[model samples]
Target chain A: MDLSSINWLLLIAALMVGATPILLAAIGELVVERSGVLNLGVEGMMITGAICGFAVAVKTGSPALGFLGGALGGAVLSLVFGLLTQVFLSNQVATGLALTLFGLGLSALMGQSYVGIRPPATPKLDLGPLSDIPVLGPILFRHDPMIYISILIVALVWAVLFRTRAGLILRATGESAEAAHALGYRVIRIRLLAIACGGALAGLGGAYLSLVRVPQWTEGMTAGAGWIALALVVFASWRPWRVLIGAYLFGGLTVLQLNLQAAGMKMPVEYLSMSPYIITILVLVLISSGRGRISTSAPAALGRTFHAST
Target chain B: MLIRHLLAGAAMALTATGALAQDDGEPLKVGFVYVGPIGDGGWTYEHEQARLALVEEYGDRIETVYQESVPEGADAERVLTQMALSGTDLIFTTSFGYMDPTINVAQKFPDVNFEHATGYKRADNVATYSSRFYEGRAVIGHIAGKMTETNKIGYIASFPIPEVIRGINAAYIAASEANPDVEFNIVWAYTWFDPAKEADAAQALIEQGADVILQHTDSTAPLAAAEQAGGVVGFGQASDMAEYKPSPRVSSIIDNWAPYYIERVGAALDGTWESKDTWGGIDTGMVEIGEMTDAIPEDVRQEAQDLADSISSGEYHPFTGPLNYADGTEWLAEGETADDETLLGMDFYVEGIDAEIPN
Candidate 1:
């Protein structure tokens, strides 16, 4: 692998595009986790979004509306998760797993007719001469809208989580639902909204995959991207900016491994193919070894069903 | 436990119905298990097409059932068992990964006929069948050698299985035969049908200056990637991806299973079916080379067509040698051709390839 042979700018550009989907999904998941909810159905929601987005784009010839369709589809599916866990007080983990399975099957069935059909192209943002600035031009300015939106979403999420009164109350609910309930905050409503937001973002991630990345709809197209997002949230320690860095790192590794293979690196292909996941797990392990400090970062009431008693 | 009891009850019911059907002269029940969705437009799509052809040929005499996107391990065993219990007389397990499950299920249902695709395992009731896809690969490799400007050909291999290995060797051999300076860059996606991964692999290859891409994985993503990269060329694998014709997709390797499917089903109906391995190639019309689009120069296109014709006429062998392993070990002497045994268990990369075959 000659260093000179690699195009650093193009690699970074590919990294950003690769990271966008995971970053979007992870940020949404971070919000959901912050609101004391663990929705493991990110994969399910994303795939549902992929097919719904692809179907709408193909039907309406509008990639923008297709993104809306994707978000709506994901939010709707999250509503089912919200209903099952919040209304019926079911175990969040099992319910999330069921949701994933349900979403996969539903998407496959919905996508049957949409398969082999191409969706209208999602256009890139035009920055004119600014986009032509040598090394930074292609890396920063020449990406589809969702790539920029994903980073903006991260910034917005970081600000909202730390700087707003609503953020305080949401954190309070996550820290102690009974305390938030005593303070008269609608904990269930807040958690439900967070879950919906998470679903919508995950859906957008899925949409980015179908409309721009692979740019086609095939059954089970998400291909475990949702699970990767879920992992990213945990690795990011529930922080928005960390999630951005983690997603890029993971995405960069993915792209780099492929580049290495293309460069005819003598290492085993399986090792290179699996390096991204292995590295992610290692980072997670290192962070988790921080023990109480790391454990304290997770929402206290996460994955627990909230029940109001007399 | 609930599913088990339910399956048992269903099996009992199916047994009674099957006996009555025999008395009532009912149609033959055929079941298909696919590794990917039927709309994949490649490997699984071709199998589904063959299933449809079976229906069209037999009409009311045959009734078909299929479970799409079935995974290939314990889940496959469960699905195969369910089909067997449901009184499916002939089952086509269409994937290399379904070998063990097919064999295990065939053992339980001794009377039923089982045909597994691209697998080596077989039993008294199970038969293995696959197209000689390497034959098609050879023609495309020749085209790639001639068409490539960079003299670097990228291959997106699925798994390190013998079937895929054979294709890599065949393509590399033919490309080198045409252009001695042609170099191969291979990336294993480790999947049969993930479009996203396949696309990413193609992009990496294109970025590394490969102008011609070949894929053993089933998806149009590679061709789409090649199209996006503009000057890059590619060939459709397993099915004719003619949609991108005249550009990135200059040609394709089509798996034509209809005739084989029709003949096998006919044999089952005639009670003449027995366990056997079938590796049909271009000569048998099982593996076809799709149309060479105008993207290829007229002379080169003719050369590709001629190569296909020679393979079809059994006048040429893609694996003929004096060939050697990548490690410089002699594989075949002068005028020697690879036998079915060597091809079936191919594990080494032929000379000129630089990558290791992942275990």
Candidate 2:
């Protein structure tokens, strides 16, 4: 293996760009699951956001508005799930799966005209002299705004999920909807709000894919990234900070493996190709398994439908 | 076994009705199962274009239907079965992964004709066909080799199938011949149409000093990446991505399946369709070299064109003799050419590729 040829700084920078989409989606899903609502329609919402973001960006020649469109697109689709599972008290698992199917079909139809069009480029942040610094600048400050936004979202989610009264109510609603209802907390409303927040963030993640990452619109372009985001949330034990680490680790491993192969590494390519998933799961699962408290991490009332009368 | 027998019986009944319907002078049904979205702007897009050409050529006499993004394996089997059950007269299973599924479905629907692309397996009712993509690869390899300032060429490969492996070797052989110091950096993406992954692979290669990128995957994501990393050039695969012309996409290897599609459909209409294998190259125009842009030096463009012409005229074979496997074992003696069987099952890289063919 020609190890010397692989540039470590650029690889790290690419990892952040690569992981931003999954990180965005995972952070959102973390919020939704924390509220005890399990929405598996993340893939669907993401693709919807992707197409919406691409279309809006292309039409307006603005990447920022395109991201707004993507968030709105995801929120609209998630609201469909919210109405069905929240107000109607439908089964969360089945509804989420159906939402995914619906989202894929809907996006395909919506993206028919938008295919092959390029979105306005999402520019990297200009940190002036800071960006001109050596290794740290390239690895940290030279990324597009979404990378910083994703990290900021993670911090925001961490603070809100653990530090605020609202966070406590959201956690209580997730733990026991009946008790939260008795405490006069609007269980259904809180869960619905959480679901929307998750959807909007997932949409933002999808937009990052179309606007910055792949930077083009293709049908089913989101591929399975939405599913990977879902897995990230579970493996990170629903901790916002762990989600950040897992996303970078997963993203880093993906870019690193490709770099390894390009550098003529003789290791089995299959192992290298799958190393991201295997190592990410191993590391996150190991970290989350602390104190034999693995089973207690998930919200107790997750996937349970709540009716106010009950 | 019982379920199989029952399905055969149902299919036979359906076929008998289908045959009777055809006797009434109905439009011939031509169904297609694609491995990616038609808008992928690469492999499947080319296939979709040919499908449209088939419709236009036959006009109202032939009807075309297609399902895009159909995953291979069991899902392919299901789609093929559905097409057969729908009284389709001829079905085209596109993609190498559809080999077994096409064979399995062809057995159940004996009356329906099946054409499997880029696959070796064939039944009595299944016909196999593929373009000489390696011939096109040789032409592009020459350009890539001549154009590279870094002498490092990155190849974004999809799967490790024989088809993909063949392209890698052909390109590497021609590339190293053009510039003995040129190197290939191959990354197996293990996917056909994942834009994000393709982009990542391209960037990784570019960062590692590769100034030219080539992809076997069915997306323009790699070219897009090369465009973003200024000065990196690439060729469009399967289709002419004119949007990136004059720079990143200096040229393209276009897969022209329309003429073949028209011929096969004509045969089916005239009742002369039979199982066979067709591997047409530059001579028959199954594979075309798209217009080279000004980005390619004039002399290099002429050289690439001459190589393409010689291959088309049968004076030059991409797998000509004097070649050695990556292990330095003698693969072809002087003036020898690779036989169809060995080329079809190619699994190793040629000499100087500096990489392993991943399983």
Candidate 3:
């Protein structure tokens, strides 16, 4: 397959770029699921973020504002789900599905005029001569700021979830909303905040996709990425660091298959195309089968309605 | 039995609406069903542009309605039925995946005319239409052949269907004609429109030492990838990606469906609409060779233009004889041109492409 011809440096760079969006979205979703809420609207929120980010970037000539706009848009859309599920006591599953449909339609409408317009460029981190450091520079330092931010967010989330009082309250609420409510924790409010945070991060993921990945706005640009993020949370057993590993693993498989195809590998293209999904599912199965310990790691109150009176 | 009753009720409701439209002096209602969003900047974008043209030509005489990003299958059938029920007199289902659904809906709405794009199956009330995209591929193949210093041409194929297969054969033949040493690396993306995947495929091709790239898929991602990779050349598929012109995108194959759209809508208005298959090529303006930028050498550009002219004039057929399958079986002998039936059901790769067509 002529493996020697491949530029390993460029390949790793592409892998990082490919994994960044999912990593961002997965980490956000990890926080949401950790709070015992299942938001299936990741796809919708991500797409909303994509169009919103692209539109604002094009309008203001600032990619930063565009990302903020994307986050705001996704958070606002998630509020609808929040209102329906938390306040109105609607079914979370159905409401989440509705959010996805609504987000897709709304994004398409908002992005209609923004199509074919390129967003403002998000400049790479200029590390001066440090970026020229042999092998590590290209792999670690030559990426856009968003890549660094995504990793930093993951670290921040890990710390917040493990080493703080608010983290304890949040995890306690997810473990038992009724008990937490009895203990004077605002269960609904905590879940609502988590949903918003998840939506915002998912929006950032979507923004990265449109503003940097493809660098153009198209309808349905998220294209099921949010759903993948949702699945990635479950695959990671709701752990923050595991989410990072899972995202990079999936991203590496995606880039590797394409590289294999480019290397003129004798395998059928269908096999190469389906390899990423198949491997992800296989890994999830393997992990979940490990003494059934990982499966029990799911938040005990996940997908459960939190009614104080009940 | 319940499903049957629902279908009957839906069909009756559609017929009732059709009758009401006839009673009222209403403008002809034309509907379009798109597989991708109109902003896809490729195949659906071209179709949407034609829809706009139809509106321009018959402003007051017709009302156009469109639903985008409709997935193929049961959802598509429901959408087509709903459009017919809502009093759409003529509908254009623009995607190869909508073939069966178009026929299914056409059966219930005999009064509504249906035009399915890039499909072969037709009914008494359904018509199929497609363009000769292979002709355009031949032109790009010539350019890729003469331009490739790596002697490796990467083709990002969408599917193994006959239409995509035909483009591969045409491109390979033209490329080989220019440079017999030219080799092909085909990657079947299995998707019609996914920008990230398309860009990745292009990157893979470039990394594999392919200096020239070709795509039958609908997206400008390949051109963008080529530009990002630096020095690699590609052609725009389905739309003129003029934004990346003169370097990475030296030329493009534009799908021009406006004229045919106007004509069919005109037929519906004149009460002369009928079920028929239309496969138009460069001559009828369905397939257009976009402007060749100055990046292509003058002689190569001129040769590409001449090839386009010949294909348009019917003097040159891209699938003409002396062709063999990849397995070394002779398919077409000397002085022989491929028949419509053979071309419509083509499933084998032409010789020189070192890849198997996935089933």
Compare the candidates by lDDT and give the number of the best one: 2
Off by over 4 Å in 3: A269-291, B1-26
Best by DockQ: 2
* Count of clashes, each model: 0, 0, 0
Give the residue spans of candidate 1 off by over 4 A: A279-292, B1-24
Worst 10 residues of 2 chain A by lDDT: A283-292
lDDT of 3 at A116: 63
lDDT assessment of candidate 2: 0.90
**Native-to-model Cα distance after best TM-score fit, residue A80 in candidate 1, in Å:** 1.3
Off by over 4 Å in 2: A279-291, B1-24
TM for every model, in the order presented, reads: 0.94, 0.94, 0.92
Give per-residue CA lDDT, model 3, range B1-359, as digits (tens): 99999999999989877765763558899999999878888988999999999999988779999999899899999999999999999999998889999998899999999999999899889998999888899999999999999999999988788889989999999999999999998887878877777888888788879999999888777877788779999998899988788888899999999999999998988788999999999999999988899989999999999999998888989888798989999989997988889988888888888777778
How many clashes show up in model 3? Answer: 0
What do the candidate models score in CA lDDT, each in turn? 0.89, 0.90, 0.87
Single-chain TM-score of chain A, each candidate: 0.96, 0.95, 0.96
* Structural similarity of chain A in candidate 3, as TM-score: 0.96
Pick by DockQ: 1 or 3, better one: 1
lDDT of 1 by residue, A23-141 (tens): 88899899999999999999999999999888888899999999999999999999999988988899999999999999998998899887767789888899999899999898999
Error of 2 at B203 (Å): 0.6
Error of 1 at B212 (Å): 1.1
